[model samples]
Target: MEQKHGTPIEWLMPLAFCTVFGWVVWHTPAFILDFGPENQQLAALYARLDVSPGLAPLFGGYGDIIDYGALLLSPLIFIGGVMTVRRAPMEFESWRAIDRVAVFIGRITMMLIVLLTSVMIYEVILRYVFEAPTLWANELSLWLAGFVFLLAGLYAMQQRSHIRIFLLYDAVPRWLQRVFDVVSTSLIVIFAAALIYGGYGEAFAKFMRWETFGTAFDPPIPATLKIMVLVIIALVAIQAVINLISDWNAVPVVHTAADDIDQDELERLKAAVGNEGVGELDVTRGAIQGNQSEHK
Candidate 1:
């Protein structure tokens, strides 16, 4: 099927995400050093967030997610959502900028999950085997897990991995299916818009202040993540709009139990039973299996 991805300049969105990612990672230590009440410039810039317990907590309702280490990612993601109709080509070889960026984010998220798992394994070994538990592993895993979950939604939309209960809609006429698509996309847009409107003030406050986790690790996971939620949801809404317009004439995608079944797995299971992996017939019936070429 044909598709459309408007304008080549949409590369700006991915650039924003990457640039902020690089900036935050680079200047984290400096931001922490300057993030204090005495430094009027940094204090006013960072809002009411303190890196450690010595500082006062003002306008800090979130966890240890507001540190200077990871503050710029939120804004980068918001920039990624600036264009409501931008989309990636369906083909991997012909992917556009947004498609590549989404894939890049997905790979990073996967690495984070792997890192989280490794930390858990290391913690287990230290606690049970060495009998010396560490303080940072649990918080570290929690921090990575939060971003993994948040970013997974955006990747899912890019790959069309979302679940759809299509029983009624698939059975309906093409026109009716189009109507259902419109209604569903409209609901998603409305929900995302409502969340941004309600949470914008809080996210902005946390972002401007650069809050931090009160724990010993004290990473800036909260403020950045709060900002991320609004940004990613807006991205999701914009993707829905793009899908709504681009797939307007898409054919009904019928799904069934058989569709969900893995044919290769089924064949392997069939072979383990000592039966030749032929279709629907018994050897005891004295019927020779038909030739594969004949069936074709």
Candidate 2:
């Protein structure tokens, strides 16, 4: 398969992610600084509950502006993220910009999963082997894992890999399939909209207060995750819309038990099993391929 090459713009997504997360990891405390003890004027701006003296100047008195700016420019971010995944082979022929963006975020989410696993492993080693477990590891793992679950949903939606009963769907005509698609997408949109409407106030309050998970190594899981929930659901809704639009004209697909098998995964397993194990693998693979063809 010929790979689609992206332009210089493709670098924007990764660079943007690095910059955001890097800033977040480093300047988190700084953003919630309380300069009131030393400077009265700066205190008014940085005033918040549970704040301490820190490097507030790093944000140059425009932290909120920068955040709002990013929100306004999210469409560009979406385009950049989409472009980042264009070089790879796509599983869906109907994949569009939103699908690419979902996949890109999903890839990032996968990296976070690795980091989460590493954190757990380190915690285990310290608790058992050294008996000096860190205070932050468990909380950090929970934080990362939560986002992973949220983001993986977007990827699953794009890949159509989420759990679904396609028995009725597969038997439907093209027009009925389109109706189903529209109805499902509308429901998704409504759910997201309702969630955001109901939760935005609380999310905004927590974010403004810069709430933290009260622990020895206090982390702002509450504040960040509250906002994250709304953001992710919005993204998922956008993806659902894009999926409906992109797949509107696509040929109706038949789903079966064979659809549960991943050919690529079978190939990987076969490769890893080697020549001695090839016989049984060949039989299973051949059967799967035939079933796939028969379903088609």
Candidate 3:
């Protein structure tokens, strides 16, 4: 399939970077405030600072200014996200505007997973081969993995690839299918709202304090993950609504056992071992035979 060239990166990068820069400043205020004051190695770095050694949480007295700055910068994330989706392939026919946001987040999370793997590999090599381990690598991996898990949900929802038993759905008529979609979307919205309503206060508190995981590496996993959970759930809910609207007019689909098959995987297997090897494989042969007869 041909790929769509979305928005130019020249524009997207600067817009996305605005949010990234603001997030860095807002989320890791200690970096600019009074970070690691107890570490002797960082003493020279601290001494050169124009600000005081022990100040408020986020830039001490300048917290209000930083807050306003971050608020102003946060909207750039949405703008960048929308623009980035111009390049995303509409994998499903029912794709909609909200799907762009989910796909954008999913792409970023996929990159984070790659970075997480590299971090783990680097840690393993250093720990076993060099007999030296870093304190930050493990925590960093955990942090990235958490966000990956959370963000992947939104992507999965957008793709309609989440766990679903389509046996009943496939048997239903168009009107019933629409009813099912509405019911499921409503449940998702309710669940997301309940979760956010219950957890918002705590998430906000942890985020404001930049709560850490309290370990040698001391990452802000608690603070960040809490906020991410609510954010991802809200996105998932929105994507569910979008799916309902976009798929409303879609013809009723009759899912089957063959629907579960991964065509790309079969092709890859054939390429890897040639057609003869694929034919000899008993595992997939039955499914292929069943699919052929079903299609006939």
Candidate 4:
């Protein structure tokens, strides 16, 4: 019999790239001090973190952590990505279709967050300490930050931790909740699909020509990365479709009073006052009291 789930071959390239990149970075001093915008920002951050003279070496080595950590995680992410693609429920096939896009966007966002935060610090230090500013700092920050801002939506979808109001949702009946989930997820998928279809051509063209930020700090990082943004948008679109499918078949379980108010609630109440209530409040208490009062 054929296997129910099999690993995808597409993950190998990224996995290999991460492994080789990590090893070279770990071994080479040149890679650590490449002086490109990305590395410069990273180095500046390290310098700031070095408060004590003795800690300077440790702080300077922070870039290696990023390099090695990415190296280590890349393979795992690849494997997981494969598993996610292969083992993903048939009902959730839409997720597989768009998984790459979500990952690409998430990676870009994280890189931007790091780059911007570092450059902002670098600029502040230059202005305050040296009484001089660098053009590279501002340009670098903007370039990196732009990429990060673009990726946030993809990351939010991948993590499934996007903000949503759940307070009123608890009161919704199970079947209706499922319907709500399907509708919401479907809408997101539609929006993402539209974005990908409209934007992918331009994004791909940019990548094909090898566009650059035109900065002095480093060699042109390929515009191929921009393609990742398109890919991620596409993936998120697929994920939304899969989520809608999965949720359509899901049976929502009603939560009990105890679950509604737990230790966290007790802590909040205690912070507000000094005591805990003796028992859970009856949700139907007002109705019960009304019936008894009428009979009396």
Per-model lDDT = 0.62, 0.69, 0.69, 0.53
- Which runs of model 4 end up more than 4 angstroms from their true locations? 1-112, 163-172, 213-226, 245-272, 276-296
lDDT of 1 by residue, 124-212 (tens): 99999999998888887787788889888877776666887877976789998888889999999999999999999998777655666
For candidate 2, lDDT tens digit of each residue in 180-241? 99999999999999999999999977766666787876677888889889999998899888
Instruction: Give per-model TM-scores.
Output: 0.65, 0.72, 0.72, 0.49
Residue range 168-260, candidate 3, lDDT tens digits: 886778898889999999999999999999999999777656667778867778878998899889988988888888888886655555565
What number of clashing residue pairs does each candidate have, in the order they appear?
Answer: 10, 0, 1, 4
User: Mind giving the per-residue lDDT tens digits that candidate 4 earns over 1-296?
Assistant: 11244343434433444445434432333233443224554355335432232422324544345444555666665555433433223212224344554654343354447557877998999999998988678766665555565567655665454676667776888787877787787787787778778878877655444345566643223454566567666666766665566556655533434433445566676677654453333333343455557999
The C-alpha stretches of model 3 lying farther than 4 A from their native spots are: 5-27, 30-78, 86-90, 265-296
Residue 68's C-alpha lDDT in candidate 2? 36
Which rank order by TM-score, best down to worst? 3, 2, 1, 4
Off by over 4 Å in 1: 1-97, 273-296
lDDT of model number 1: 0.62
Which pairs clash in the backbone of model 4? 98-235, 101-231, 101-232, 102-232
